[model samples]
Target: MQKSITNQNQENIKGIIFMVSAVLILPFSDSIAKWLSSSYTTIQIAWLRFLIQAIILIILSFSLKYKITGFHKKFILVSIYISSSIVFLFWGLKYLPLANNIALFFIEPLVLTLLSVLILKEKLQKNHIIAVIIGLIGTLIIIRPNWSAYGMASIFPIVSAIFYALYLITLRQVSTKTNSKSLQFYIGVISTILLSVIIVVCELLNIDSFGFKQIDFNDWWLILLLGVITTIVQLLVSKAFFYSKASSLASFQYLEIISASILGWLIFKHIPDMLTIIGAIIVISSGLYLISHERKNSKT
Candidate 1:
């Protein structure tokens, strides 16, 4: 009994540490992406970020001696999720404000929770319903859409959120049936292919000449660092989820809002208004409560 308790405590500590590390790193990653988005088209930046991560993922997978599996059903689902998410995210960032964009992206957890009921056949608990409400209200508060600055920009992030939710739901299902390394590999492969297609089409249409235009030496270094950060943050996120209960980790997700809010003020000089601050607190409290309650029920 003592040994079991000790092991459990150890796991909990490790999980909390991993989860916090992941949560903190994500905002920094977003800040970096936001910086890069200034110089490159969002799509080009997204593509390059993943392209570099893909190469690193491949190298690490081989070095770690994870098995390279042949393609399967889950691989296809993974591919679809990755491609859709990358496309939608790139397009969304082109329109939305960074904080608003991320707030909309937070809609993913609610969507994922609902989808799990339909697809994974998970129960639609009361907590889940409440979470959806809180998330929706939070989204509405953040948007407060205006025609001049917000018109279509408001729509893009919501669409991105939906696609992201789909991606998360599908990824969860696929993860259960396959190794994480394999799932990661296939996602990278699919995204690289998808982005390559977008790059080719951009060439054919001569959309902006920006996508294929030459980047300076400094930008090149930033892009390289962008790739490295992308890969590392992903690993940290995976570790967090792997070590902790999903519900526990899910609650910590709201930490990104707090982080983004802080970073936006300090780094970008963009501060959340009173409404945003209130909405963030509401969202965070509701999400944390729901997650903790769910965890308690699971234990019982």
Candidate 2:
């Protein structure tokens, strides 16, 4: 079916756009979260973030009569993995600089790519393999191998990478019949519910980690910004996965490092050293070429 191929090609192109936008914009959200972490507990920040995200998405998805319907049970697992990932990531962000936190988390793309092929049964073409490898090399160069110094903070991101990679894999498996908005809404809702239960349970059990402190109205704006960014990014990521293989989408994640670097320097005055800049250049060049190649092939 020529028409089918054409449709899939268009979807592939859109997928690339959506995935790239998600990765790039997500860093801004991460930057904000890192800044906020100093003033809030990770569980406190995470539960509230998911709540705001759920609220925003529920409003945006109001028109979808069946906004939270028909997803596989696997989505529950997806919610757990993602919530765990976020909790771990926020812990890392609180202790690590924005760029370093993001660099360490970049390992998710590699983990996702591996799971895509080995677990999801997606074909890993030579070019994709090359793209992911190049992306990692660039990421490693940026971090420059001083990971041990970050200590426990660094370990959190690694754990996050595993959870996030599993989250994406599970999401891809369950997104075939699901539209992006509804899927995003479902995740927001489920994740919100999951985190709420966790936070409450921690409180009931006399766990002091996520205790609710006196509220500050001032921080609501930052929380709103995070919700908006996360909601929109999740929409894009859901769309991307709806249109492309998990492995194909992973390479685009490297673009986040560049954004993280710029946002870090601008907001926190954490300048990127020479190696970071060079690594970013390598990542973008290879990523752009891969995108162009995919587009040309799709046209053919």
Top model number, lDDT: 2
Candidate 1: tens digits of C-alpha lDDT, residues 29-103: 677667766667766777787788778778987898777566666666656665566556555655555677777
Error of 2 at 28 (Å): 1.4
Off by over 4 Å in 1: 1-24, 233-252
Worst 10 residues of 2 by lDDT: 60-69
Residue 148 CA error for candidate 2 (Å)?
Answer: 4.1
Pairs that collide, model 1: none
**Steric clash pairs (candidate 2):** none
**Model 2 misplacement above 4 A:** 1-4, 63-68
* lDDT of every model, 2 decimals: 0.65, 0.84
Q: What is the model-wide C-alpha lDDT for candidate 1?
A: 0.65
lDDT of 2 by residue, 67-105 (tens): 555766777888899889999999999988888888888
Model 1: worst 10 consecutive residues (lDDT sum): 242-251
